[model samples]
Structure formats: C-alpha cells, structure tokens
Target: VRAEAIITRESGGGRAFHALVSSDGRRIEADLLVLSCGVRPRTRLASDAGLRTSRGILVDDRLRSWSDPRIRAIGDVAHVADPRRYAHEREVPGGPAGLVGAGWRQAEWLAGALIAGEDPSPFAEDSPGIVLLKSRHVDLVQGGEIVPDPFAPGSGEVASWADPRHGTYVAMSTTNGVLDGFVAVGMPRAAAELSLLFQRRGELPSDRSLLLRLDAAEQPVRATGRDETVCICNAVTAGGIEDAVSDGCDTVDAVGCATRAGTGCGGCRARIAEMIDEWQGQHV
Candidate 1:
C-alpha cells in the first residue's frame, strides 16, 4: 500500500526488550523512551454519545449539537458552525473547535450564551492565529493570511526587512490598505505589535515601509484606542490593563490574575509585561 509502513515485530515484556522495524530500514529498540508526533481530535466519546461528526463532533453557531441542542461542543474535538452566510466559516480540519485562542473565545461566548443568554455570533475563519515558536535562540511570530503576495498590485501590498546578524526577518502583508498578515522572525517587538494589529483588524499605516522599522509601531499602536483588544482570548484591552494597574495590579501575574491579559496563548504576555513596565516607569 502507498504511504503505508508496517511494524513487523514488537516485544516489550519480561526483561523489557522491544525491537521494531519500518519499511524504510529504520530499527528501534526500546521499553518506551518516547514517541512524539502531531496530535488529532479525540472524537470517540462524542461519537459514542451519538452526536454528529464531520472529522469531529459537529455543532451549530451556538455550539449546540444538531442531534442534541442541550449538548454544546468545544475545543480540539469539536466541529463548530458559523451560522451567518457572510462568515464563510465552517467545520475546519482538526476541530470541532481548534486553537487555544479560538477555543477560549468559544468558551467565553458560550459562557455568555449560557449565563447571560447572549446570542452567539459568526466566527471569522480567516482571522489570524498568533504563533510564537518556543525554542532557544529562535523567535518567530506569524499571523493572518500571508499568501498570494499582497503586494502584487491586485491584492494589496507587501513590505519586509531583514537583519542577518541578529537573525531577524520581518514581512508584512496588506490587502487594499488594511493589514492582512505578517511574519516576524527574531524581531520580538515587531512580532508583538503585529500580532495586536492583526487581531484588531486595523488598517496599515499610510507609510507601509514603517512596518519594517522598529520605532514605527509604538505611537501608532498607542493610538489604537482602549476599546481595541490586546488579548482576544480573555477580552483584555489596553485600557483594561491600565485600569488594572491603576487599581494596584502592578505585575504581569497580578494583571493576569485580575484581568487575564497574558494567560491564554501567551502571545500577549510580552506586550502585557511591556505595558506594566511602561506604566511603572511613568509613575516612578
């Protein structure tokens, strides 16, 4: 069979010696050192529970299952539906719900729907996912739809800057003047602000080249206003953090405990820390 490899022999008992051979001439002997790889949704329980499944447990915009309205779905094992026709979102792969931020968003929305009777809204499927690589000497953050080369005169525009010595690479994409996406490698400050911009769906600065400069994001980002989100997962904001600090939440942990600004995907944690330090500097 194509793309199929079989394990011929396995023995991991008694004195604990096991040998496994793959078709690619790879052999391993172990009593289970570690087998790590990408993961998938856990849908057995949902399937046994007799809910609809399309690669995951399916649910409507309110997160209620079609077969059972009382049972709402969420997280990696759920397939959520956005009811609005314009949303252009549906059961994406690796979900009933997926991504920590989106999961938390669903949770908050669900909490409101259940507690305050708030109606659920459509999810923006094309919304960016902030990805920060957690590794030594490697800093990377990516968000939004960056393909199709936004700068090619049809979609929008693209601008980038590279610093090979400190190992920094930054590229920003804009579609019809609004920021579409960005990728920042070894440029933590740009990564942080770009993530915020992507989340807020803010327009690009008239001077697009400003995106590649380290100093440009600060003042413009400050003008994004307090209402624009700083943490979508927890609904935290620039103003919210300011108010929290004024109320004596001085540290990042304290602010997180108080307003949950830096507790989700942790992409916003750096920004939150900066906000705290900046606030303390002004007071001191």
Candidate 2:
C-alpha cells in the first residue's frame, strides 16, 4: 500500500492531500478530503477595540497595540516581527520561533516594558535554528545559502538523520566560526539549551568535542519569566492564564473558556492540565 501526505504551498492558496492505504497493501484514491490543520488569528477584537490590524493586530516593541497603551498583545493575535538571519536581510513578521518559548519571551518583554514605563523593542533577531520535536531530524541552513537543495549533493551533510530508531538527530551549520542555523528533532530539551547557547555565544563551538559535550547534557529548556504566549492558535498564555486564575477561573476548561487556551487542536491539553494541577496543589 502507498500512503502519502502531499502539501501544496502557493501564493493564492495552500492544501494538503493525504492518501489512504488498504489492508491488502493497495493504494486507494480519496474523493472526499478531510483537513486537520489548526486555528488562525482572529483580529476582530483588536479591530473592534480600534487597534491597527493587518494579518494580525499590530504591536510595538512592548506588544502594545497601536491604539491602546493599556492593552498589550501576544501570541497569534499579535503581528510581531520575526527575527531574520544575517544571510537574509529581510524581516519576518508575527512572533519568534512560533513556539511556546517565543510567546513566553514576548510576554516577559511586554511585562517588563510596562512595569518600567518603557516600550518593548520589537524582536529583530533570527534564531540559530529551531528544533522540530517530531521527525527525528535536524535541518541546518545559513543566511545567503540559497535555501539548500533537498535532493542535491551534500544535502545529507546539511540534513542529518531522520531515523525513528535512536529518536535523535542534530543538524547545525556555522558561518565565519559562528553558528548560523540548526534543527534538531526529538530533542526538545537539547534544542532549547542549544538555542540559548547560540544566542549567548553568537558563535558556534570550534571544538567538536565541546559541541558534543554540550549536546550530552540532560537538562531540558525551561520557560523563562518573560514568555508571552503559550498557546498560539487561541492566543492564550501563561500570564494570561494566571490572570484568569486570579480572577477565579481555576479549571482547565474554565481557563480555556476564559482565556481561550487549548481550544484549538488540544495539543496543549497536557500542559494546561499540568498548570491546573500545579495551581490546585499550591492553592488547595
């Protein structure tokens, strides 16, 4: 049987096609299609509030909407600038890394800026690379590298293992003795720490042994105090959840209804449950 996931990305529209396989190892063409993607931003509230919105509500460095100083935005609802690599001199809009960590950082920056009576600086830096928790592979790229050929020579060198066996892979690249990009799969904890290391050093490790040593650490990346959005599709965040809890919405379902967390796809349901358990443990 042949099964495939076909993805089409175009300027006008995009779609994904999934092929079905029969028990007898035969491939069957599907006439009916089912799409299981995720939620997108709903900027009507920001617009209703008189905030400037394009694809999403526009926010400044402090995540303050263009219309109201008292209102700040994070997560998918906010159209924040993305960090670009040195290779690509252009800017990508709407959040950094597109992960929980990115939202958390935005939240922290906004909070600090608000408390200090200063505007937060919009994010304008590129990550060395992002780690994909699934796929068990890493993709390494650099700025100005013409987005490597997925089928050409040296592609394997740039793209590491995607083996489902060992459940680990490392893909990284360096330019002028500095790490430019990396993508690690099935190594969320390692990926998080490596991201921090890249930011702090602004350079890759020269010694292969040291690089290996760093990778061997057992610690996973922990969220920082400044993180903004924890759930992107619904725009819910740790801080937002905390605010909801403080307002007496304590259960996960309550938080979802109150702050709109875990309403999309429910991928973050486990995390929300953990938060609820922790809150109850501490309070009750």
Candidate 3:
C-alpha cells in the first residue's frame, strides 16, 4: 500500500487509465481509478455563532448546543456529544452520524418538541445506523459495531461464510444470540433479512448458518411482514405500501406520493415496487 500517496496526474495508454503520476514521481499503474473523496460537515456557522464545534456542532442528547440550549442543530451539521443512557459523569463522545435516516428522525423529533409542544425524550439514534449502497450492480448492506475482534475477551459470537466464486460474503457478530452487527455483500435476501433482524433486535436462529440459505437458488424468497419497515428513511412499512396500493396507487411513484416510501435514498424503491406488485396481484 502506498501510504498517503497523492496522485498529481493520470497517464493513459489507451482509451482508459494506465498509470497515475504522483507528486513524488511515482508512476502507479492502474486499470481503473476510483475517487472516493469524503465529505466534511460545514460547522463554520455554528462555530462563528459561539457553539462548540468538533467534527460538527457539539450538542446534548436533546440536540441543544452545549453553549446555547435555545439553539439546536440537526442533520449533517449537528454532532451529538451526549448520547442517551450515557452518564454525564462519563466522558462525552459521539459525532455526526452522516445518515439521512438519522437526520430525518432528528428533525421529526425536534419538530414535535419545538412546535407541537410535546414532551420530547432524549433523542436516540438507531444505534449503529444502517448503510446501503443503492446500486443495480452491487448489493451491500452494513450496520452496527462490526469492527470488534471476534476473539476478544467480550467480542460476542461471530459467524461468517464466504463464496468468492459467487461474490457473496456474510459476517455477523451477536451477543447472547442477539444480532449486534453485520456486513453482507452480494446477497440481497440475506441482507434484507439481516437488516430487519438488526432493526428489530431479534434473536438469531440456533443455526445461524440458515441465513446463508436465503440466497440459495432453490429457496423461495420470503415475503416481508406487514409491520416490516419498507422505507426506513421515512419509517414507511409494508402495510403502508399495501394501503397505498389499495387506494389506487398503481406505480412506485404513486405509492411514494401516497406513503413517502421510495422518496429517500432510493434504496427501498425496488422493495416498494415488489410490494406494489404483490398487493396488486392479491387485489386482482
């Protein structure tokens, strides 16, 4: 691995990239170049306004700025320093979650507290927020504290399976038979089931390897439950989509307009479409 090598320019041998010229005069040959420049939270406004800033505007569990309780922050800018269940006596930690769903949840809760005059409890995130890569060529889903050493003193039970030939991999960590963290690649069915189980904090079956069977060719795809969240970004459920379909929503867009299912992230659009077809078939 070239540590901290900065690419200055690209050289092409044919139609595509052939090599990268670095500042230190290193020519790194490559067939494909993927640029993955990450984002930084813009906290200048908060910092200039005198609110503490680190990675983002540091806020309490209530999302109120430590320096100014009247001033609140949310979305990509707010850094939650004091999370729920964390004692004040303990060191403050946490930062911007960088997830749209988390931001949506924060906004919804904050609106209720500010405008609706609701007694809002401490804002709690869906711990270890789910990440989905919405793409046709690749199916990847990850969530929770996945980096723990499985063999560590208290790392919990870890199970993994790989089929490199099929480009499928599954690895999960659980505590006391409960799913804690997982990463699934190239296995859509397993990813969906794992996501649901992670969200619900459900227990894994005794034979955890059963999850592998979800992607088998002979195994029929399981139907989602009515209560299962179809669009996590909007908290839209399968039943919600069914209701929309029953109300004459024929297309995915119509269902989205009716229930706001596929509007966020677009990862659940395929699922919404599937639900629409299933429900429409039932009606027919």
Sorted on TM-score, best first, the list reads 3, 1, 2
User: On residues 1-284, what C-alpha lDDT tens digit does candidate 3 reach at each position?
Assistant: 35334344434543555577676777787656766444589988887888777778878888888888888899888888763444333454666877777888899889989896654778887545787766567778887877546687877899888888988988999889899899999987788778889988989999988888878888643344677666766777777888788889999999989888888778778777777776767678
lDDT of 2 by residue, 36-91 (tens): 34346788877887876765666655566656758777865776532222113333
Worst-scoring 10-residue span by lDDT in model 3: 1-10
List the global CA lDDT of all models: 0.66, 0.52, 0.77
| C-alpha RMSD values across all candidates | 8.1, 11.3, 4.4
Error of 2 at 211 (Å): 3.9
Q: Model 1, 1-284: lDDT tens per residue? A: 12223333434543433555555667665444324233478878877888767766777667777668789877666676543431244544435434566677777667777786656564334355665554445667777656546446554577777777877788888777677778888765566567777877888788765656654434533414566466655657789988998899988889999987878766666667777787778899
lDDT of 2: 0.52
lDDT (Cα, 0-100) at 53 in candidate 2: 71
Residue 2 in model 1: shift from native, Å? Answer: 13
Instruction: Name the regions of candidate 3 deviating beyond 4 angstroms.
Output: 1-3, 6-38, 83-92, 126-128, 147-154, 218-222
| Candidate 2: segments with Cα more than 4 A from true spot | 1-39, 67-70, 81-98, 117-165, 187-193, 207-284
State the number of backbone clashes in model 2.
15
* C-alpha positional error of residue 138 in candidate 1 after TM-score superposition, expressed in Å: 4.3
C-alpha lDDT of residue 160 in model 2: 37
Which residue pairs collide, candidate 3? Answer: none
Superposed by TM-score, candidate 2 places the C-alpha of residue 105 at a distance from the truth, in angstroms, of 3.0
